[model samples]
Target: MKHKRLFSEIKADLTKVEKELDKLLAVDDPILSKTCVYLLQAGGKRMRPGFTLLSGRFFNYDFKKILPVAMAIELIHMATLVHDDVVDASLTRRGRPTLAAGWGNTVSVATGDFLFAKALEMIGKIDDPGVAKILADVSVEMCQGEIQQIWSAFDVKQNFKQYYYRIRRKTALLIGLSCRLGAMVSDGSLRHMWLLETYGHCLGIAFQIIDDILDIIADPDEMGKPVGGDIRQGIMTLPMIYALQSSGHRERLGQLLALKNKKEAQVQEVIHMIKNSDGIERSRTVVDKYINKALKHLEELPKIPAKKALRELAVFVGERSY
Candidate 1:
C-alpha cells in the first residue's frame, strides 16, 4: 500500500496489459478457455508487467512498443506458475485453488503449455530476433533451476551458494529480462538497459527471499497455503538452511526434518525451533543486502519520476507485510 502511487503512475498502461492478456489467452475450446480464465481471474500483483512499464519510462516511454513485451513477460510468469502448481501439487495460490488442484494435472499442464506458446507469439509480434533468443535462454535457465530444486529436495546438507543460484535462475532471470525487454523495445541506451537489468535481478532475488520467509511466518489465510508448507514438501528454503547450519539446534532440526515425512508433527516442531534460532534474522539480513544492491543501481538513474518509484518499489517488495 505504501507504494500505491508507484503503480498509479502507470495505471493506464497496466490496464492495457490486462486487456491484452485477456485477448491473448482467449481460445476456441470452452474447457480450455474456462480453465485458463479461471486461473487468470484469480489475479496476481501483476508485478512483472508493472516493472516492465516503469522501466520503459526511462526513455521515450512508448506505450505502443512496450505493451507487447510487457504482456509477454507477464504471460511467461503466469505459465511458470501454472506449471509450478502441477509440480508442487499445490492446493492453493493467492487464496484460491490452484489449476492442478481444481482441474486435473493433464488440463493444468496443457494450460501451462498454451500460455508458453502464446507468450512466444506475442514476442514474435515485436519481430526482434534478439529478444526472442533472450527469452529462450530464460526458459532454459528456469528449467534448470526447477531441476535443481527437484534434485535437492529434502537434502539439508547443501550450502547457501546453491540456494542463491537456484533462486537466481528460477526467479531473478525473468524479472531481469522484464526490465531489459522494456528498455530494448523503446531503444533505450545500452547503459540504461544494463542498469535496469541489475536493478531487476537484485530486486527479484530479494523478492523471492522474502517470499520463502513468508512461507514460514505468514498466516495461511493471507498466504493462500499453510505455513511451513515448503518443509512439508521437503524444500529447504533459506531460513531452514540458516537454522540447519546453526550450532545450537542443528542436529535437533535435522532429526526433526528427517522425520517430517513420517512424523508430520515434526513440521511444526521444526518451524518452532527455526523461529527460536537465528535463521529468520539472518535471512532477513540477506534480504536487505539484495535490496540495497538493487537500490545501488537505482541511485545511478537520472532524476526521473520512475526512478523514485522504482527505488520505492524495490524497498516495498523487500519489506512487504505479506
Candidate 2:
C-alpha cells in the first residue's frame, strides 16, 4: 500500500491531534505563536503520534486519554528538530526556512525551549508518574546523544557500537516511548506494550538509517535541503561508516571527510565516492534487518487492522526516500 493510504485508518485521530497542537501552541505573544504555528504547519508524517494511536487500538482505544500523550510526543519531536537546526546550522526544512534561519538562533533557541516546556506541561496532565519519568529520561538521553554526536564529529574511526548507541538515544528511544505511552495510557497488557515498544524501537533505528542514506543520495529538491548535510557537518552516519570501513576509496574518502573546512566540491566528491561503494547497499541491508525485527514483534500482537498497519509502516520506514 502507498504511504498515505497506510495511515487512512488513523486519519481522523491525526486530524484531531493537529487541531489540539494548534490550540496548545497558541500564546499571547504574536511572534512566538506565529513561529510555533509555522513549525506545525511545515508538515511532518506525524509518525510518532500515529504509532501512539495505532498502539492504543490494540486495547481500549480511548482517544480522550491518548490524544494528550500523542500531542506531547509530537511536540517533543518538533522541539528537537528546532534545536537540531540551530546546532547543525541548517537553513531549511521541508523546503522552507527553518526557525533558526527565519527568526535567528536566539529566537529559535527560545522557541525550542518554549516547545519543550509546553510538551512537559501537556504530558503532565496525564496522571502517571511512570509515564512522566520515562519521557523525562528519554529527553535527557536525547540531549546527551546530541552532545556525543558533537564530540564525535569528524572522527572517522568511530565504530558501529558507538553509532548504535548514539542513534538509540537520538532517534529510537522517543519512538519506542510513543508506543509504550500509547499502550500504557489505554491500559493495554504489559505484553502488548513491550511488543509495541520493541517494534517501534527497531523501526526507529531503520528510519534513522534511511534518513542518513537520503542525506547522501536524495534529490536536493525532494530532501528540502542540500544532500551530504551529515558529511558536511562531519557527522559520520551508517553509510559513511560502512564506506570508510570497506570501500576501496576509503583513503580519499577519509581525507576529504577529515578536512576542517571542506569546499562544496570536496563534500560532493565524498558523497560520490560513498555512493559508488558498498556502503549504501550495506546500509540498506541493515535497514532490512531492523524492519524484519520490527515485523517479528508485530507478529505476537493481537491480529487486528492496526497490526497490519504497523507492518506496512515498518516497511515504509525501510523504503522511504525522504
Candidate 3:
C-alpha cells in the first residue's frame, strides 16, 4: 500500500494548523517576528503532526478537534530545533541559515522559549489534563537527553547503552507521546492508544537510527547539512559504537576521535573506514530489530486503512534513502 500518500490526504488539515501556529506567534517586534515566521515558513517534514493525526483516526477523526494537539506537538518539536541549533552551532538547516546563525544566540533562545510557551497555550486550549501532563513530562526528558548528549561529547568511551538511552529521551519519547496524545484527544480506547504509542516508540527509534546512518552516508544536498556532523561534534552514534566494537580498527577509531580539529581529508578517511568496518551493517541490524518490534505493534492495531498506512510507514523508514 502506498501509505506515503496518506499524509498528503491530511494536507489540508495540517496546513490549517500551520496557519494557526503562525497566528498565535504573531509578535510586535520586527526581528523577533521575522525570525519566528522565517523558521515556520521554511517548514519541515511535519512528522510529529502526521503521527498525531494518523493515530487520531482509530478513535475519533476530527481534524478540527485534534488540530490543537497536533500543532502543539509540532511546536514542541520546533522549539527543540531552535535550541538545538544553538547547541550544535549549526549554520544550516534545510539548506538555509539557521535562526541562531541568522539572528544571534540570545535572540534564538528567547524565540525558542516563546515557541514553547505558545505550545503550552495550545495544549491548555485542549482542556485535557492527561495530554498536558504527558507533554510537560516529555519536554523535561527531552531537555535531560540534550544535557546528557552535551556532557558525553568527546568521550570516546561512551557505550551503546548510553547512546540508546540518550536518543530514547531526545527523539523517541516525543514521537511516542505525539502518537499517544493523538489517540487520547481522539478518545481512543485504552488498548488502541497503547498500541499506537508502542508503534510510535519503536518506529521513532528506528527513524533516528536510520538518521544516524544517513549522517554518514548522505551528501549535503540530499541531507541538507554537512556530512560527518555528529562525528565532527564528537557525538558517537550507533554506527560509531559498532565501529568501536571492532578489535582490528580500535586504534584507528581512537586516532579519529582524539583529533582536536578534523580536516575534510581525515573525516573522509574515517568515513571510508567506517563504511568498510561492518559498522554500517551492525547499525542496520539494530534498526531492523526496532522495525520488527514496530511491525508487531501494528499487527495488534485495528485493521484499517490508517493502520495499514502506519505499517507502511514503518517499512518506509527502514528503507528510505533520504
Q: Using TM-score as the measure, which candidate wins?
A: 2
Task: Please list all clashing residue pairs in model 2, or write none if there are none.
Answer: none
Across residues 1-322, which tens digit of lDDT does each residue of candidate 3 receive? 2443757656677778778888887789887689888998888878889888888888778887798898889999999999999998988888888999999799999999988998998888887888888888999999999999899987889898899898999899998888888899899988888888988999889898888898898888977788888878888888888887883777888689657578888888778878878888888988899989988987877777778777778888888533
Which residue ranges in model 1 land beyond 4 Å of their true spot?
1-4, 259-262
Worst 10 residues of 1 by lDDT: 255-264
Predicted candidate 2 versus true structure: per-residue lDDT over 1-322, tens digit per residue: 3766887888899889999999889898978989988998898888899999999999989999999899889989999999999998989898999999999999999999999999999878877888888888999999999999999999988899999999999999999989999999999998989999999999989989999999999999978888888998999899999999888889999988877779999998999999999999999999999999999999988888988999988977877843
Could you tell me how far off, in angstroms, the CA of residue 275 lies in candidate 1 after the best superposition? 0.4
Against the true structure, candidate 3 reaches a TM-score of 0.95
With a 3 Å backbone cut-off (N, CA, C), the pairs that clash in candidate 1 are: none
Each candidate's TM vs. the true structure?
0.96, 0.97, 0.95
| Stretches of model 2 off by over 4 angstroms after superposition | none
Candidate number with the higher lDDT (1 or 2): 2
